[model samples]
Target chain A: MKNLHVNFCGVAFKNPLVLASGVLGVTAPSLSRVIELGAGGITTKSLWREPHPGHPNPTMFGTKEYFMNAVGLSDAGLVKGVQTMKELRERTKEPIIANIVAGNIQDFGAIAEAIAELSPDAIEVNISCPNVESEFGKPFACSRIDAAAVTKLVRANVGDIPIAIKLSPNVESIVDIAKAVVDAGADAITAINTVGPGMRWNIDLRTPILSNRVGGVSGPAIFPIAVKAVYDIHAALPNTPIIATGGVNSGRDALEIMMAGGTLVGVGTAIYYHGDATWKKFTDEMSQWLEKSEFETLSDIIGIFHKA
Target chain B: MGCCGGGCGKQNGEETLHHELNTEPRAFVIDRMWEEAENIRTFVFKGTLHAKPGQFCMLWIPECDEKPFSIARDYDGEIWLTICKVGPATTRLFEMKAGDYVGIRGAYGQGFSTALTPSPSPKGRGEHSKVVLIGGGYGTAPLHFTGKCHQDAGSDVTMIIGARHKNLLIWEKESKDSGFRTLVATNDGSAGIQGFTTHILEDLLKNEAIDLVQTCGPEKMMRAIVEMCIDQGVPCEVSVERYMKCGFGICGQCVVETGEKMCQTGPVVSAEKAMTFSDFGVFHRGAEGQRKNW
Candidate 1:
């Protein structure tokens, strides 16, 4: 097939397709398996400074077109997170993106500093998780000041290692938030953590589906929103790298995000629809489409919509 | 992929067909509900998900959280789900009666073989193949379906079921009625043999010329059976249970220590592959994927 390699925020990836955080990225073994399956890079599940139990059972629910989850960013804490990264580095050379989440701004820096000790490929500041609003109040990404504060703190602690500020689409103006994080020293931006703390209910029992009653909605339903988020952010800051994550299920969706200015396509929920080999299947589809279109490389299409 | 004997291919094709049909939860009318054992009820529903022996379905009780249940029976298009009253969702499910409406999707995960043409008997006991099925607790639910399938395929199936006591044992009469050689064990010796199912399995492995050993039960018991099968040089498949959120592998809650997500790769895995999981008998992750003592 065609070469699907790409470089994002100074890190080389075999393909633009990356295993998004929170699918099968909970452990080192699962992360390594995703790398073996064909993911160009893998992001660990959002790590906390201490172990967070997250929400109770019925934390997640899925329909054919959409999946909603309120896992509450539960992780084994920074100690296990560092050990997992160390073990992962020993096993595979695949790029590792350490995703850090915290209740307060200072904890974000503390966790980032702890993870930086292990020297991951990049650090992703998860300031936009919508599902934990019950425990943490509003997401940091909801306000530009809060978003920039979290990014600036993490950026100061991580040294020179690139930091990607994961942004939320639920904000009033995603472009403004993206600009704030970029101005605050974010090396890259991952748009759209999940759309809405949406809900599903059982009419018969008159009760909510998820134990949390509401969760971040993902899967095919959020693709257009993600593309628009990437497009808007890219339009505002052409120099800032973007990792577009939302509802990318197929290669066409990945190409759409790239065309809209995404440097990498983050896939998580699609693993349910396509199985573990989703990355390979998506890349193969993209290669065949590229070959037929006679595009020499991914850069030829990345941000093509901007020119149009 | 490990021990289903050509069932995986058909399952893949059926999955594609189901995907094309609709991803929405289909309405299943509960036709019957039998209180099989203490805090356990078996509900048979008229639905249209073509599930294999070891595969599972996401039983949706509307507003009460969808949980993954092993396909206990799939007679024609009627599906059976045996549930234990464990949590809020299942407690709500237990309160559900016949003619009630519930939603079901998938018949997901890898299952035990339905097409297992067991090796011919070594003692020349006709063309019937000898297959041993050991079940413990609620784990016996899925094994009943597997035993029936094997029996229908002209396999001499022996079902050894164990529970904490006689009142806890499920599907014993059903297996006996189906012409399966039924054996029972209880922890308090209120039934057939005193001790765990593994002890009976050890005796069976020694005396009986068994072809395949299939088991589903408490992780410790299953792990013990896996070790015994390995020592006896017998190929075995065990059904493993884990906390599953999204039944199609999106949620990582059901992943074992071997990095295999049980929701997709298996609920039914080979004893060899199960042995590879460091947490096989030791621990399982909870809803948030935190390691919990099994």
Candidate 2:
């Protein structure tokens, strides 16, 4: 019956729960359903310039700890996604964050220009896509320069709409990338994308589990990696608002992410593994745990590991 | 007849059960039971779940990897899972007592919708519209629910179920007693009609002016029946299964690309749309887009 509100990068969340990008914010109706089920906010599936054909088939694989996907930032682009945003905004009282990914520096500005018209509460820049490989191809958010370039490009044009730079877990030094985005005027940080060009093979078929041959590994398997990124980024920049992503499934996972320095936990694979009710379950369960632990507010738990 | 009869049908208690989404597994207890057949039984659970009928829930017991089973029936505060002791989870499930605690989460995947907007039934199941429900293996569960729904809505129902042998046909008596004109088939001719359920379905489709046909089971058989329905112009819905790791859309593990993620979009897809699926009844994809040959 009690309300659990928290602030993520200055935006207030009724709860510290958000539907992570790529975690089933595929359409307006589904996103609306998630909000009705009590998520704090909904992040649209990361959108791109054109409708990405993505891989042929078998785009994802899984393990007990986690799963992997190389969906190639598969999307219906911003123009089509705007309809979903319009509907979500019209129906749900929750904040809507538009996720944008581009293949080139200029593309970031173009997408920012397009999404600014949609009038979402925030924008998340995904620079961690492996699909951005060629010189002409989109670049991953692993490097400070590449990440910064995209950030500055979007920030230069997209005014007022808060921007959260999503970081890559594959990088050797995440701190550099985090700092680079911060310098580029990012409003917040969504730590860690799916890790690696992960692979799996079925012995019976003598073939790989995914059609792309590699994918970003996610699920329960990547929780530790996600937690570490949040912790490291928080330690490096104490004031930076972080949205922890990857393998978070339950209220405990959300609490751990917040404790590790993330202000809000993103539900990606968990929504796929679980369902919308899980979001409500996470908030109720985590809030109860937090209240019982004598934590005064969600802010009180942020980065507790560092103090210990 | 009401929506869920025999105390085995209910939607879910997601709206009422205020469970926090914690890592700790939630507990469930068996509230009632429906003996479908000798070994196949429908276990009605009074636990918290936000489930869709065609979607599945993972049953986890310590030291045992969780296994997925579809929701056979649903109503407020409860759901019925028709299960067979085919594997580890089911075997362990069979060992559970009425008062025993079980771990459960999710009612994952998109479910079939019968156009709740009060459209005319394709096979007007108002006690006069003839309908045929076909199921094989564990596929009988959802089809049974479909049959019950039709019967509740006043449609005359005929159900055909098949298995390897007479002993394998679960839920036979219930199908017969439920006022559904029941037909049974087995590969070994141990009982009921000899040969595949599809053959029986084909004969019925040929002979009767059946209004609607819904089916589940092995992909090949479902496809064959679906193809038959398509040829006959009888509307049909199929409950599909995927080797899922996460029932949600993110892990992308259980995607059956029918132009959308199956987990998020559907577990029950129309025969019309399912025909467009590249892997429909033939293959499923792995993480790399490789055809995971079924």
Candidate 3:
């Protein structure tokens, strides 16, 4: 009886694996392509009311352990985001979550309101990108007050659309921030953006690798932090849906996070590590694990460890 | 075997599954630089890549832009890239000196498979593979390396190079010197044969038995060659280019209309697959991943 489908905040996903924001999230066709490859939902890359140039070339680099991107939130802006959402929404019945980012609290409201007109499955407010420190110093997720204020503002503008506040792992108390956003009217929480605005120096050249010098760390390196964050968030707000995204590269990793209290597991950097089959591979591995464990359904394991 | 050994798991051991590797552009000293033709220059870095023919490197110039360049040659623990001063990045590269430093990452892309058998009949492995490589301008750069591979593997290699004029044709001398058969064509009839690479390919197909055809150049020219090969039932592979932010497959910026993430599924695609891309031979995505006519 076990199946991968899950209903998160009234939106039914074929599986819990959502295409994480900011990865293959730009174009409608590209987003549709991810869904085609087996992602249960689409989370468009963080968009702003206006187009962002992001950073220059050498924006990203990777290794076996981690993937670093200082892509500085390069997006074609909200107009394109809406246009792409419309196109992608028409193609598939799978849920689309419009992920939006901004420099100020009010702009978050404005962007969220604009995206609400399209009536996406949900709206993910991004208050935590580690790479844009120079432009917007210290993400709002660092403080519970700012996180709540941004959440309240977005909740006010987004009409009845479900709101998931994306938080950064760099914070000292993810649970406090999660509770604050929930109290401020967020219906769900996407735990952990990229960890550590980390950097690397090409020692042979004796210089920095990324054009922005430092970028957010992602991939398998940050999976543990993601699990811990999701664990705490779900423990604090057991009723609120949680989208756990950091580095769930395999089926076991997906189940591990859900066991740690994640409702929807997000897969991003794994695409780089595992190729286009990242979604298929994650689902296959997850289904196999579930079958072996004799779980009646995938939802039966959500926050299972927290029960004990 | 520092990084080239089978342990890396990149196209290693049994399955020849080539993949995109996570890479940072590490600086390499330009050992030498030379002028090839009008607006074309070759830079040789004191660097080596775990790469094969038809693979590329993301060439970076400090304050300039980062662009992918086909590895013209990988020899003597050094990497060579050919560039034409067509854009901002290449112009910056053209301005650099021999002693200067540049950055390169990869040896990425699913490259050409030298193991070729003509389609339809599926020739026996007993006979040496005969490959016809067509290059337009600097597109011939990688095919130069490819011709060497086919020749070294005991296969017969013929390189048909095309350009707007004689001065634009590249890799002719290198191909001939490497002992592969060389053919040339130009729009103005200033080289070996006139008209286009397709004209040369037509004659070659009419006259000889080609086990495979690999081409890279202008999209339209390659399209013609691809169509011809598909029609004749000759196996073919073509190297394609598009606006790519990352050489790795994650970006999805380089996914052509056929849903082919060119960096992963190909920069080298079989002729049959190319036809299915619908977007192939038509338009390519610009920097913003927007479609623009070829």
User: Chain B TM-score of model 1, please?
Assistant: 0.91
Per candidate, the number of residue pairs that clash is: 1, 47, 0
Query: What stretches of model 3 exceed 4 Å from their correct place?
Result: A292-295, B1-22, B117-128
Residue pairs with backbone overlap in model 3: none
- 2 versus 3: better TM-score goes to: 3
Q: Deviation in angstroms for B37 in model 3?
A: 1.6
Models, CA RMSD each? 3.9, 12.7, 3.3
Per-residue lDDT of model 1, residues B100-169, tens digit only: 8877777677888656654555455666677899999999998878887787676889999999999999
- Candidates in order have lDDT scores of 0.83, 0.72, 0.83
Q: What's the C-alpha lDDT at position B91 in model 2?
A: 75
Candidate closest to the true structure, highest DockQ: 3
* Tens-digit lDDT track of model 3 for A83-186: 88888888878899989999999899899999999999999999999988899899998999999999999999988899999999998888989989999999
Candidate 2: where are CA atoms >4 Å away? A131-138, B1-130, B133-294
